[model samples]
Target: MKKLLSILSFGVIAFSCQQQTAEETNAPSVSEESLKAHIHVLSSDDFQGRKPFTEGEIKTVNYLADQFKSYGLEPGNGDSYSQEVPMVELTAMPSETMTISGGSEDVVLNVLDDFVAYTERVVEETSLNASELVFAGYGVVAPEYGWNDYEGLDVKGKTVIVLVNDPGFASGDSTFFKGETMTYYGRWTYKFEEAARQGAAGCLIIHETVPAGYPWLVVRNSWSGASLYLDQSGENFQPDVLGWITRDAAIRIFEASGQDMKNYGEMSRSVDFKPFSLGLNATVTVKNKIKRDQSKNVIAKITGTERPDEYVIYSAHWDHLGIGQEIDGDSIYNGAHDNASGTATMLGIAEAMSKMKTKPKRTVVFLAVTAEEQGLLGSKHYAQNPIYPPSQTVANINMDGITAWGPMKDLTVVGYGQSELEDIAEDVAQTQGRYIIPDPDPGKGYFFRSDHFQFAKVGIPALYASGSYEHMTKGVDYIDSLNQIYLNTQYHRPQDEYDPSYWTFDGMALDGNLLMEVGLRVANSEDWPAWKDGSEFKSIRENSMK
Candidate 1:
């Protein structure tokens, strides 16, 4: 009996050793060296900041294709690695000043200073000539929340001035529109769309730094430059003009109308808040240089051995602000941390996947999308015209900005509780001696801001996360300070250039490994992650699967 027991124990020990060896051998090699090389090249001036519809686009796409080919990855699109995305470039030149009248006194807001406006219309010119202006609170119409800012208000042929965020942010009540966590209703994109649906001729949001999650400078720099949009073809509802006004500008306009801006802002926090006319008229014209063009979404994939029909996708936007308003005498917005890091990380994962000893059972695709800075147009186009059916596409793992601040004790998942993908991510994170946390600053609406949101809208469970906020060695405060510096100084600015001096990739490598393992688990298994019950995307996915 003792000899038999000894033999069984030996067998168990041998089996455990074999399993560990297999895991170690099959683990993807996501290296810091690879990540740094990709980021440095992509963010270099030679890429011209990787803007679409420019020489930068040509250089960037070709480089990505070359890298994928070098890694022995097959083209994702049939017979080609590039997917053409049709777009229209609109360089709107608004009038020097927006004039307000019919108030106690006329007030003129300077363009790019106190106000910034642009039009999505494809026409050469559009205008708001003395359009009646109404204050429409947050411009949100959520039936579930029983809040309707446009109720009983006819804004047709008029301009609606709304607040940037929703009432939940103002009230800080979790039951009210998800509290400080900004919902889609709080996003400026939603405000404009709602205004257009209400038949408003124009929509302007009042920008407050904290609620907006960015300063006036970011607004000016982003909106003032040439913008790109998916070729609308007159299919969508877009107001004649969409814009933003600084808080100071809003105050002046309100004062001219004999109303206190502070009081109105406080009142907007309530669900019963009603829309009212500001007794003012706005006049402005936007002349545009319209150019229709095509951008490329670089795609590469590895076909699964067992389940080639099912897919797992990885995405990162490869576009940035490009050459724009000069800041500190530098015009190139290198977007090193904005997206180059994320793109590099994706490439690292691709390299590791390509070198795997055993390929995943489900097809794995690497999608490097374009024009995300211009409101996620590349991803939007792909979602609308998908190569793989959304129902068959198992999941999308998106990487936006990757932290350079070394490894973290936790991974921050944007829109944390929305999907079962979070559960998978949590399991994978635990293997690395790390944990998962929801985004600390949900008021930024980051989940909707990135390319993953497009996939989510189409019912594909998407995961966007990074090792952030709690550095392994530096702690939380260190990460926060770095984030603040990046937000205040480098974000969307020319100063976003990569400097190897302080930038580190150990953390990025850790994140890449985590993402790779999660995707591998999904791709090799028969699981299709579903959205959580309370997620807004849950119904869309359920209906599609049916």
Candidate 2:
């Protein structure tokens, strides 16, 4: 009887081991509880809005490194997990009012109310003293589109006022500069760069609610404080002033110049539009308090057992607007949804990957970039001075934000048709009984807004996607209404705090799982995803491979 009892106990123990092995063979599950916990800590006020060059930055980077170490990930950089990004912080205090002359009548515009401006030049003071003003249409110079708002026009020593978005947005013609979808030329940064290249003294973008995708208050809030820029080693060109003016203020300027603003706006929709002088002169001075410092991009990696040289990167920005002008008695821009959620999602994915029983074939990197709000500076630095060869880098999957409105039936891919990664994402979405969709509003230029754009420019296939639009229990309308509310009231404001009673994490978990599976497939496979034929990045990738 004793021998028989011993035999049964051994069989039971063997069977339990088999079951545990089977569970380990499958992908690890992403936990909503884990994600919520991470978001709660990162978005807390103690982080001080996670701004670079502050105590907030020190805490944020250290926390990320600690979390990665806990997940068993090795430091991505040799002997260190932080990549130092050199930057300059410029706090510009402009004149109280900009005075305009050489028009029908002199017009004075209030600083923050009617307009907001700043200088990227590393100088103590820069001024536009009676600089001639020109209306440069969209201020775009795209050779491929056969459009040049500054064609045969000299803007040297002058201030140019340009429209907010590209002409294709106004015409809605699919053949015209990518139709309603904004190209790189439509971005405000591109406009400023082009103006500086044209030797313009200053550039002011006219702000329209629909075209600019936000109210004037967003422009005021974002540009009013200290702004960060790449040190550039004094190589890049920057205008004396870069700014935005309210629609009302723009109208007054146009009226003073004896040109109907509405007529010029209509004419700008055509490719034949030409830049013309507004017959106005402007005067303003900016005093800058500049500080040069170093910020960090936190990185960690799970080295592949097989092809360790090739890599698949997952990236998210860890910086926000920081402490600013108080609103609603709350001075912290927690960036709960704007990016803390994304950083948490990356952490959740890293934990899952670290626990995988069967490791990936290619190295997987988790990168938390800095100064995305200041303009994708960390990623830009990495792209320019890559630790890994761009040609050997397999792909990049970026998360800017994750939905908190519960699970969704569809995943929206920004820059949907740019590469073959979307195809893989679609297949992964199907496994979860979800479909893939393109961004509903492409004119906002979201594809160019995030860190992924830096990778794309350097010839790597990158995917920026999330599960949004069609909720599981609530319909599409419900999701749309929530998005509107968030954008109008909370976006870029101090009120963008985490609220446990209102926020949910199931949706974030689902999206995180989908992204993890997509990345895992890429990491284990031998095939390198290629850019779609007409993609602007195709040539760049092709040349790099050669």
Candidate 3:
């Protein structure tokens, strides 16, 4: 494994700074006011939460393209600044009652409260009658880890209620499936996918705050709206019904089957665990209002001086939890910090590149994608079918939520140990007296949750660095507290609106510059970054680069 930069190399930081082309008149000053201006417009209430296939998306993409034009940047896709992403919007409305019958009495699970169900199959009425419920422990089937939660257990055409996260978390065994640091198997998406692979009719993950990393409220708000997915002509690669049930609901159902959920959770952590047949059977009926439309990905390019073909990408999702459930009587989700901040930062960096006196050797593309709140659909589409082919794309630096409390003393590199891009982040962070830290909670599997992961999937080394949690004014504890507050109160809620009083651009401003500098470093470099040891993407990168 590659060790960190030696302490003696700290003095070499100034030497590294000398290689930068910042002295050129073209190096544009990225200002806090400019960042605020972009955020104000994009996250404004007028944008209607920036939901795709709505007026919000139209306004968001147009404004982004217009800004790119005003900044004197060229269109990224063909001759147009916009690239259409055809999607099928499904507003699935479940029946009021989901009956789970087993013992003497039948339990009627409430929709949007107890569980949320969805089917990607393009059908008018997708209903399941008396689907047997199977408790499949963690619901993971990885041969590499000698794990198969469904080993010798047949769950085909059954509804499997599994615990969220992985065995390592429940058992607190570090050697078992990455221990606290969640592998991809710990991700909810992986659980659902594995169920589909096993031919399970339905999959419902039991939601626990510690393991899932968010309160059940977040699940309700996020899952209770119109969901957007890529319009595919082939077979839908998803379960007939995928859902999440509150921990309370899972416990009640298990108890009805005479199994203590408290002990059942403990049993899941063991490799010898077997599937429990919950005598309970599930009945589901879903009615969906489907709307087919095309959303645009706003693409703007600052072409390189030398290797115009080789590209460097800067990305940020422009979608949020859209106008959904009300909070304090406010329906607008504003998404000011969730992504409006990242979108603004992407724009600010692009603007800086536009004013540069010297263009780098590789082209830089700024992509503000749509339908991110729907599961990074926009970036996935771009990765699968690129206007700029993924092979030519050198690196992707994605900006998501940037800590806005104030100036920070450190930077947290998500997927920190996965690639050499962290080296670039570390080098730049040192110049500003800021240190580099890995994602504090890898068990959340945040590395796979963002747009950069899509790029990485296609063999491109991608960097997504979260803003420092350690603040200069209040210390790291205060910063962590603020993050928890955002998670509990503001995230994905109407309260996530912009407010200069409680937020600041001091730290975000520096972050934007760091993104720009990192991109410049890669764009101007002769060698491409390689995925580091222990990264699943390493072999893929090596093969693709070869």
Give TM-scores for every candidate, taking all chains together and pairing residue i with residue i.
0.95, 0.95, 0.95
Q: Please identify model 2 stretches exceeding 4 Å from their true place.
A: 1-25
Q: How much is 352 displaced in model 1, in angstroms?
A: 0.3
> lDDT by residue for model 1 over 493-528, one digit each (tens)?
999988878889988987888898889889988989
Number of clashing pairs, model 1?
A: 0
- Candidate ranking under TM-score, highest first, comes to 1, 2, 3
Question: How do the residues 1-546 of candidate 3 rate in per-residue lDDT, one tens digit apiece?
Answer: 122354336335533552343553246656789888988898899998998988898889889999999999999998899888989988888878788987678888999889888777777768778999999999998888999999887888999989888888856677888887888888888898999988899999999889888889888887776888899967777878888998888888888888677777778887678887888899988888888999988999989888999999999999887788878999988899989999999999988888887888899999998888888899999988899877788899999998778877688988878888889988887776678998888788788888998899888999999576888647889998888878889888888888878788867887887778889989989888888888889888778766
Q: Which 10-residue span in candidate 1 carries the lowest summed lDDT? A: 13-22
How good is model 2 by TM-score? 0.95
Report residue 18 deviation for candidate 3 (angstroms). Answer: 11
TM for candidate 1 is 0.95
TM-score: which is higher, 1 or 3?
1
Q: lDDT values of the candidates?
A: 0.91, 0.90, 0.85
